[model samples]
Target: MLKAVSLGPGDLSLLTPAARWAVEEAEVVAGYKGYIELIPDEVLEGKIVVSTGMMGEVDRARQAVEHARAGRKTVMVCSGDAGIYAMAGLLMEVLESEGLLKTVPFEVVPGVAAFNAAAALLGAPLMHDFASISLSDLLTPWERIEQRLQAAASADFVIALYNPRSRKRSDHLREALGIIGRYRRPSTPVGMVRKAYRAGQFVEAVPLKAVDVDKVDMQTVLIVGNSATRLVEGRMLTPRGYHRKYAL
Candidate 1:
């Protein structure tokens, strides 16, 4: 059995029962070194661990698949929901390439995504329609990322940005905000959560124009609100329009 399990944003307590079960039942656990380290020593005890560093996803996926193919129970861990910017897609691709897509017993164990976790800390900023876009240009072209930012902004969709900034792409988040500014007002509420539900947690709601871009990093999740979103009592909220048809 091969399972792509999500470790949630952080905090071991947030790990889902299913994800924990997959890990406990697995003979081998593989994931990025950072995520692997999040697993409790008790859960990882007596298990074969295959941990890799940054940009080592392909190798980890291949090793997990090979272990599974060899009749071993294997789990590939991811930071958030496996299906969202995680190892599930890559594992599936590798399985298909190995002609084991149908023959292999595989599953994706879902957990809290960064956007969901961040939104919870920032109140209901996602009550209305929203779009999630990653600013990383490693696999996708910068032009394409910019196009998505433009489209999401012009459509008035609440935007959730992932991988907003990094050492190499220091200007990506600033550039993205610039594109969003073309359509959104400078006063739009923007929620920023760093290390959501984890240590060094930082949550703030600021106007779009006031965001301190320098403080944002890959660990941050930024939620830019729509025209109707507001900062109420220090919380970011996007109304669902319930007041339009029904009494509050």
Candidate 2:
């Protein structure tokens, strides 16, 4: 059997029970090296761990499927929920293409995604309607990302940005800021959380125009508030109809 387990951002405490169980029972585990490093030593003490660097998703998926086919319980790990910008879809596609979709029994174990973890650290910035967009154009076109950014900004939806920047993709975040600037005010609330729930975790909120794009990287999650959002007592918040409905 093959299990796709979500490691939940970077904290072992955030791992769901099902995910923990999958890891505990798996004979083989495969994941990006960074995520593999986050797993507790005891959980992986006797397990066959296959660690790969970035952009190794296809190879990792193939290895996991091969292990499962050999009658071993294999688990592929990912940070955050497996379904969101993670390995679940890629693994499924690989399995289907290899004619093992039905032959291999598999399951997906869910975990708290980065957006949700970052939101908790930044107060309630996502209390209202929101959209999550990835800035990385490696697998997606920059034009499509720009279109989505424009639509989300124009609609006044709170935006959660993933894969905001990288060494080779430095200019994308600046371009995204420009697209968002078209519809949002200069003083709009923006919160950035890096390495959430992990070592060297940092969370801060700054005005939209003052956001330090240079400080944001692939490990960070950025939240841009909607027009209705505000910073109260140093906390980013978007009221969820409580003022009108509850008279608070």
Candidate 3:
């Protein structure tokens, strides 16, 4: 059986029971280097490991399947949630067409994604209806992301920004914030979460108007609240708990 597991952002503690089992029992663990490193060396000591350095995502998926077809238990790991802009969706799509579904059993184990971890760092900024949008132009074009940003802002939905920066696409995030700023309030709460799980983590709170575009990189997730969103005390909590309408 082939299992696609999520390591849960960058934090080892967020790994679910199913994901841990899949990793520990697998004979071959295939994933990006960062995720592979997340698992301790002792756990994957004897397993055959494959590392993909950003390019050829589809090729790596094929390689994982070949291992599975050979009756090797393969765990294709991904960062954050497996399905949220991860390898689970693409792998499943191609596998179904190739009839690998009938030959090998597979599972997608859920994990604590970036938005949840980032929101926690900023408080409850996503307590209400929210939308997650990626600024990456690798597959989805920048034009499509721009359209989503405008729609999300106009609808008063809290927005979670993923893949905020890369070498060639550093300015896309700032442009997105600019577009969102036009529709939302200037003081809307914006929370930046860096390395949510791993070491050297940092979280910052900023108003929409005061955000510094230079602080973000590919490892960051930015959460921007709707018009109704506000920073309370030091946290960026969304009011999804209980309303105080009846209170004095």
**Number of the predicted model whose lDDT against the real structure is largest:** 1
TM-score to native of every candidate shown: 0.98, 0.97, 0.94
lDDT of 2 at 235: 72
Candidate 3 local lDDT, 47-106, one digit each (tens): 999878778678888888889889999989998888788999877876787888887888
Q: Weakest 10 consecutive residues, lDDT, candidate 1? A: 239-248
Which 10 consecutive positions of candidate 2 have the poorest summed lDDT? 239-248
Better of 1 and 2 by TM-score: 1
Model 1 stretches with alpha carbons more than 4 Å out: none
- Pairs in clash, predicted candidate 2: none
lDDT of the candidates, in the order given: 0.93, 0.91, 0.86
Worst 10 residues of 3 by lDDT: 239-248
What is the alpha-carbon lDDT for the whole of candidate 1? 0.93
* Residue 165 CA displacement from its true place in model 1, Å: 1.0
Residue 240, model 1, lDDT = 95
Return model 3's CA RMSD, one decimal: 1.7
**C-alpha lDDT (0 to 100) for residue 168 of candidate 3:** 82
Best by TM-score: 1
